[model samples]
Target: MTLKHLIGLVRALTVFVLMVGLASAANAVEKNYTVQSPDGVTIAVQEGGNPDGRPIVFIHGLLGSRLNWEEQTSSPQLQQYRLITYDLRGHGQSGKPDEVEAYRDGRRWADDLAVVLKASDAKKPVVVGWSLGGVVLSNYLAAYGDAMIGGIVYVDGVIELNAALIAPHPEVYAGLASDDLKTHLDAVRTFIALCFQTQPDPAIFERLLSNAAMASWVMTKTVPSMTVAVADSLPKTKVPVLLLYGGKDNLVMTGPSIARAQELNPSLQSKIYPDSGHAPFLEEAPRFNQDLSDFRNSIQARK
Candidate 1:
């Protein structure tokens, strides 16, 4: 090669190397934080990635922690987004405060989220909630619906949690009403098996058990109230919503539930992973990440 061409090549390679180095440096510094709720529950959170990128917050279900969304937080598609995930007040690394009243409604839970966002100085974030996490998100939007939030992604969750709870179907109702964690889990597994058309995984069951055993009195209060509230007001969430469900979800009756949810809010957009059940993020991480990325891009593009 001519000396001129070689010099040009060196400069181009140097620029590429610098860009990669900057990205690597940015990826290395994932920060973790803790925020105290109004009721004194210290919730754990982790924040990192492009500080100027769109903020995306993930909320887990009844018996889960921020750890459940670890894949989303670390995803390359999410690298350009400021990702945040946290444990509910009584679950995961968060403080388990006793008393059902503390968890009765999603108001305090919303406050907890607001505090965390403010503490981190994050912009209006697009919140992705799963199962009970979706309940909390709906409640947050219902009570504090505003432009502060860019969008909502209900991952196997909905605006009317209580409606799902009260839906007629002796078998499903019987399954949801069980107070025994073991029995509830069996029902969950059975439901999963039915929906997925396959045997349920023992590892998933064990994780559910671990999450259940840690539940506080507060977590229990969240169930009935959240159920009723959503039943009463499922159609009001007008924010951009994406309902992603697992066709194999055992606890949630997919067809009827999604149909009813869409009926309540005509603006609701949805997608279902046929081969997966309740935990799509865990069961199909790559596809889940891609779908989420595409959704986020669409949201960003609109603005």
Candidate 2:
């Protein structure tokens, strides 16, 4: 071939490759950052979907991280809204402070959430808190009130550490606090299994178990006694609140937990996933996502 023709052909191929790269970049919709909490813990944050759309912040349960919301984060049906999730102070890639105060203080957890919210620049975002995350939300309400949030969703949330609202699993709890690696690992397995009444796909469960294993051992031992101000917080929240529970939850008591929350806020709304357990967001994601979208829209309509 002539040199000129060879050069032209190579240029054309280069242009084609550049176009493909641009197309791939356009298809990617997620970004990540780290936020420093007031007490200096580094919290990892991730954002996905439409950047300018209304925001929905998801707070995962105990021993979980941003990985817990993959179902919601990757959904095409719910991609219209901006989705934000983060690793709690002691879990996943976030900083794991050795001090008991960092893990056991409700205000510290609340501060971590506050830093994430500020970092996201989410305006009145719908906050979805699951399990231990619900306790963080209650603490946030107690510390900061409802002025910054659009709505709240508590999914099989822990309102308090009260035995009346928590299903008894004494051996499991003690095992979790045990210093022996075998005992703690077994307890983590048992606790995770209890989160799902219908077993998740084996691969999904494995990934979640790995996530749990990454958590700080000190955090697990200290967090059970973490103070929660639900009694003072939920009743005083002016924003719309939702209680989304798994009817068959093996961890938190569904009816009693809901009743306790409702007693505090008479206007609280609730829904139950009859066949699911602690992790309804994972067990029944499509329905949970739809319910979440509808709840956010309802809140917007009222504003």
Candidate 3:
């Protein structure tokens, strides 16, 4: 072939390769959808990663939305798994019913999760819950059982919230109940600070403060009563459980909680991030992601 013709062919091949790469990148982009709960509340859902891969649903804590899982969703380690996140009712973009009864009923939380799972078409998926989300997950298992879930991961979550268990964190309840906006915000800020062993990024701290400020007061007041004895459910759970906690977590007493969980379910596996606090997933993303990936792989192997 002539030299000019060879050069032209090479250019064409490069253009074709570039176009394909761009197309693949576009295809990998995450997709968002709106899922409606049985009670008519709308949940904003985001799905990404391998479409046909094992589903992993992440439920964020009180005053937290699907955005809380940005690190996990964007991590290359989880790109091979189907990742799902959604705003819990009364948080984020989801509808907030003004009635106290809405947030007080534990069934509502479970039902909302059921709808999200059904909408996502997640079959026997691995469910990960953080903080209040842990309570929600327990409520779900109580109401729906483990038929639809293959595994559970609790990240600095509450297993029980009886007066004794909650007594140590008066600041948390005080922050939630404060009538003065400044008092409430300040308390919330303190609570956030307590969640980390080290100071968080300024932007992240600001964002968390903003999100906490948006939480409905009624929901805050009602959540304490909504919790059931999740430890009771452990005896019946046959699925693998990974309890991830922050050793420095002043919010949730990790030792007692983990001890109680292991006592109830001997098969339960756990790991503590000694350098981290309440939100270990955020405080130690690399290690947390690796643990999550390992947990996911173990579950997949059993399946």
Candidates arranged by lDDT, highest first: 2, 3, 1
lDDT of 1 at 282: 73
- TM-score quality measure for candidate 1: 0.78
Stretches > 4 Å off in candidate 2: 1-28
Write candidate 3's Cα lDDT for 236-259 as tens digits: 899999999999887888888888
Better of 1 and 2 by lDDT: 2
TM, every model: 0.78, 0.91, 0.91
RMSD of each: 4.5, 4.9, 2.4
For candidate 2, the TM-score is 0.91
Q: Clashing pairs in model 1?
A: 162-227, 191-250
The models' CA-based lDDT, in order, is 0.71, 0.92, 0.84
Indicate the residue-level lDDT of 76 in model 2: 74
Looking at model 1, how many pairs of residues clash? Answer: 2
